[model samples]
Target: MTVKEIREKSNAELLNDIETLKAELFNLRFQQATGQLTNPARMREIKKSIARIKTVMTERELSNQD
Candidate 1:
């Protein structure tokens, strides 16, 4: 997800997305372990997306503390 898209979502939605992405990441890792992964690049994409979401979440938290 793009930063703009992530920023547009509510905190609840972002949290849900994070949980879902984490589950997918776990599944992808399992597939890799079994040599069944068709797209290893997806793992990287998911990680980056998770980072982007967390960054936005932190930004919001810090702004709120001001």
Candidate 2:
């Protein structure tokens, strides 16, 4: 997901997305550990998306405090 799309989501939606991403990440890791992962690139993409969502969430939190 793009940062623009993430930025447009409400805080609750972002939180939900984060939870979903975390679960997916965990599953990906498990697959990798078993040497059954078909696409290693997906792991990187998910991590970056999670980071983007987190960065946007932090920005919103900081803005609210100002």
Candidate 3:
């Protein structure tokens, strides 16, 4: 997801999205281990998406603290 889209999500929604992405990442790893992953690039994409969400969350937390 783009940063703009991520920024639009509320904190609760962002947390939920992070959880969902982590689950998907876990499943992707399982598929990779079994050599059944059709789209290996998806793993990287998911990881980046998780990072983006976390970045947004951190930004929000810092803003709140200020």
TM-score to true structure, per model:
0.99, 0.95, 0.96
What candidate 1 gets wrong by more than 4 Å, as runs, is none
Alpha-carbon lDDT, every model:
0.99, 0.93, 0.95
Model 2 lDDT-worst window of ten: 6-15
Residue 61 CA displacement from its true place in model 2, Å: 0.9
User: What global local distance difference test value does model 1 have?
Assistant: 0.99
Model 3 CA deviation exceeding 4 Å by range: none
lDDT of 2 at 46: 89
Candidate 3 lDDT at 28 equals: 92
Estimate, for each residue in 1-66, the C-alpha lDDT of model 2 and write its tens digit: 998999899989988998999999999999999999999999899899989999999999999999
For each predicted model, how many residue pairs clash, with residues at least 3 apart or on different chains?
0, 0, 0
lDDT of 2 at 20: 95
lDDT of 3 at 27: 96
Model 3 TM-score (2 dp): 0.96
